[model samples]
Target: MSSRFRLFDRTAVMGSGYIFAMVNRMQMLYYILILPKHLVQPYMIVGILGVGVLSQINLFILAKYLTSNYFVLGYRGFVQLFSEKIVRFFALLGIFFILIKVIVTTLGYVEIVHQFMFPSMKTSWLIFVLMASGFYIASQGMEKTIRLSIISFLATIWVILVYIPYFLPPISEIHHLYPLVPGEVSLHSWYGLLMVWSALSGPEYLVCLGPWIGPKEKILRGMSIGNALSVFEYLVLFVACLLYYGSPYLEKISFPVVNMIRYLQSPVFERVDLILISLNMIYFLYLIALFLLCLYGAIRIVAGRINIKTNRKGFLGSVAAVFICMLIINGWYWREG
Candidate 1:
């Protein structure tokens, strides 16, 4: 394959293909139920919708600028393309940043889980499962993984559509949604919204998307639509949760999104949050796979450039080992009593 084509394939194929498997039955339940805990009712609806919109726009700008600078413009006449040295530098940097973000996020999640669900569950087990899956999916290549993502995304939507009515009855007090903007929005509120903004940014997989689509115009159009839909979905769910659970109660819970669904109970269904947790796991797994792919691909390029392909496996293995160690270290700090 041509160098340009290989790079393009690497970027676009990996993250999205597995989207179907990304969210399993449980994660769909969780994403629908748990994520709304931070915002007030219908207003949270507005907030998250806003978050989705802003995030898409911001990400678009970021992706465009980054791609142009890195690939097209060529920094200071120091071209990075096809140069093993530059690729290795970037790969290492990527691994460092992603490790920091993943470790922190995973630890925070573990802390939340311990405080809420399965207090006795060892944190190490979570780390092990995540790392194991991360290694497997990432090693498998982008094409195979993205197919899973497609199925997972569709399955999640179907499940949510089926459960819509469960949240309808308690969705009273439409008046609570009257004032779109609350009185004297605090600095804390503004800062809190930033986190939501960042969350909507999605993964760096968009970097790969640039090459896969090839034509900038087509890639731009698709990304715009995809980002818009993502924002809409988040907003819709946020509003639904707000209408169902008042802001006062919703704000108190850590994973209010999942708890939102717990209110839904039938004679046949008990503790729907259990199912939601499973879905959340899939989302988390998706992120893990993404990080490892970027890390390993960079490693592969670096190894190939040095003509040390013979030890490529060992180099990639070390990359995983390092991430696993980071997970353990961060997990300890975050999980500490």
Candidate 2:
């Protein structure tokens, strides 16, 4: 909220909290929707693993820095090393960065919903409902947001387990992963693999959590564990995609992971993917709420620089000010796209 420049929740942040934070953040990227397209058939598996290893380096670095003696410096303390002008520049830049990220992610996810679930509904209405939910959660403060994340993580994580059928029988295409020869592995192949590395997002941004983590928590270690879990999750998902859909068909699917889930037939229901996405609604909402908090931090920085201040009662307005940009972007994008 736009109260006093509060740093983090006074409540304790545990190791499990850090793990779930990183897990939810990384999962929030919606990589399962678009990542398979970035990767080609041959080396995609290896690259996803490579992404895991390389991304950890970033996690460790963020962990290394986030371990401040000052009990996890919020953005204010993190910016002290820079001049006032640089601080202003970073604050402004961060605001734009958060705004852009929120806009793009919201629009993209809404489009996916429109494509699969709500083809008959108005996109504007969808955006309104989404932003309203986000505003409510974001205004409540990070404590609720963190709790929602843990709950979302636990709820949606089962979807991963339910995909076990993908590994066997009529689905498995592990044979397509053969031919790891020198001639077959070209530079472009490696480049496509490298592209998967970029899909390994969210961990590098762990530094932003410095203020939110509990005092006694091993922020770095928890983050590292989260990164490991994230990497392993991606690896499993990528391989599953690789084996299930092969090369030619995989590139054709925009949301291959979801598509794969759509085929899942449980004993209780036929279209288990619908249930998956339903429970998964929390993870998506958790993603939006968490990002809103981060955007709040950026807005706080800008407000401070401009000598503009708001009282604790102004938290809702602050949330609105931050999210209005996203609403505009979504409207414009709906028109354009």
Candidate 3:
């Protein structure tokens, strides 16, 4: 039971891991990189500013609500009986949410990779690599994930800063942003943005980490830093994509961020998008590990309170096995679809 609690403590760090994972797995290959072929640049500006803004706010609210109720109060307050029950319920719900998200992301990534990078590679191989990496990281637990996240986040910032000059020259006009908000934002777009934003909630990763953290204040501080990092990363990436490609191009590209950076040419460098892709891949790997940790945590909470006996290694391995199986099934489905 105590080890189960420990796992949840670490998962709280991995909750927000999906954001970076999404950026790499879904956003890069599918949208931005493909933008120039379909849409121009102006429409993308519209989508990013309009849809992106609403999405962040919506996701923040959802994160705040869910994090407070499930991770912070319910699971973290392990000593309390009432909190335990609430935590268990929310843990299951979180598992369901993450599973759905992982499936959709896996499908989207498959499409992106199939279209962009490796048309020749079988999707199952990709899944295997992803699962292998995910399992390796999940086995390490939360501390390494958190530490690695900090490093990845820092490294990406340096990469962006180093490459900033190339993108500076082709700055598009703000008048391109003329009609800011459309007639009315649709519910579907709103939902999309909300999903994007909710995708940033990383505190759920902390569920696996709570016990490891000595002081309550330290956990709060970590959550603050992690969430802030997520918001800032999204904002910077969104702005970079919008500024480089504009809204017109955004509507066309499958992954705007990668496309925005791909064409970057200097005397020294030809294609910066390659570097960005590598960096994003690192981030995504870290994020996937985080999600696995979170799933492991959630399962532990439910299993423990229910008096199901399972060791921590057994529990984590079981969850990873399940996730990998799901990824395989999803990959094959999308292959046929």
Candidate 4:
């Protein structure tokens, strides 16, 4: 292998607790464009922060319990907090959710890449490449996955600066930032408010991460800061979308966040969004690995069947099966389209 080309260093393992928090933030970065349309209003910044408090509530609930509980009991300790049957049942439900999410998210990103990055490429080939990339990261163990998560976060943090154009006028309307109509929040807006909470969904995987962290490191500060940063990023994106397109119009668009990035072709570098989207795959790949690792944990929790540690290939096979299903489902959609 050439020094110029590298995959990942196999020997470099880092603190899982530190990496997990940053990974938490990375997982939710995609939500910046999507959630704003749901929750932001004319009083954009204030509206988002107001809704943000509610969004962070559920995250805080899990963070409060998990960090404290994990510090003392770890996974078994946290698991025993619930009845044996109850914990297993929920873990099974989590398996179902994570399985669907992993498949759908990979398929969705593949479609995005197909549309934006590789218009002429075959979707089948793209799916194959994606699953292969995911499996590569998965085989690295949770330690290495966390390491990649840290490095990817550093690499992609600059993408946030790409939004500077959207924040300025006449692309953005300053008038939209003011309060328009004031009354009791409508049921639809209320429902959208609740949906903002989903932006914080991926952090709960920290519970399964206890084993990955050695006894010396603590996760409380890591999880708390990570959770806080995810919410803050969501708020910034949410408001940015509202500033660009007011609430009513924002809701009509699909993938507002992605489009927000798409709408701005940088004055400095043309079609910067395209380059950013390609760079974003670095973070997305890490997230896919993270999700698969979490799915592996869920399977162990519910079935106690597979030992991912000893049989690395078994874990990779299980992850491959999930991604393959995306292509299987894609056929039905293709036929309909």
The candidate maximizing lDDT is: 2
TM-score winner between 2 and 4, please give it. 2
Query: For candidate 3, lDDT tens digit of each residue in 294-330?
Result: 6766777667643444356565566667667666666
Question: Compared with the true structure, what per-residue lDDT tens digits does model 4 show for residues 97-119?
Answer: 88777776667777777777788
- For residues 1-337, write the lDDT of model 2, one tens digit per residue: 3555442454655455745565545644655567776665656666677777787787666656666654365655656767666776787787676666667667777777776788899876777777778766766667667667667767766667876788888879778666443345567666666656655666545555655665434665666677777767776777788778887888888788777888777788887766666676676676677777776666666666334543444455656665676667666654422
Quick one: ranking by lDDT, best first?
2, 4, 1, 3
What do the candidate models score in CA lDDT, each in turn?
0.53, 0.66, 0.53, 0.65
Worst 10 residues of 1 by lDDT: 1-10
Q: Where is model 4 more than 4 Å wrong at Cα?
A: 1-20, 26-29, 43-47, 68-88, 180-184, 214-218, 247-252, 262-269, 306-309, 333-337
Collision count for each candidate, in order:
30, 0, 44, 1
Determine which window of 10 residues in candidate 2 has minimal summed lDDT.
305-314
True lDDT of residue 204, candidate 3: 43
- The Cα error of candidate 1 at residue 37, in Å, is 3.4
Per-residue C-alpha lDDT of model 1 across residues 202-262, encoded as one tens digit per residue: 4344453233323433444545555665665666666665566567766776665555566
lDDT score at residue 327, model 2, on the 0-100 scale = 68
Q: Candidate 3, residue 252: CA error in Å?
A: 1.5
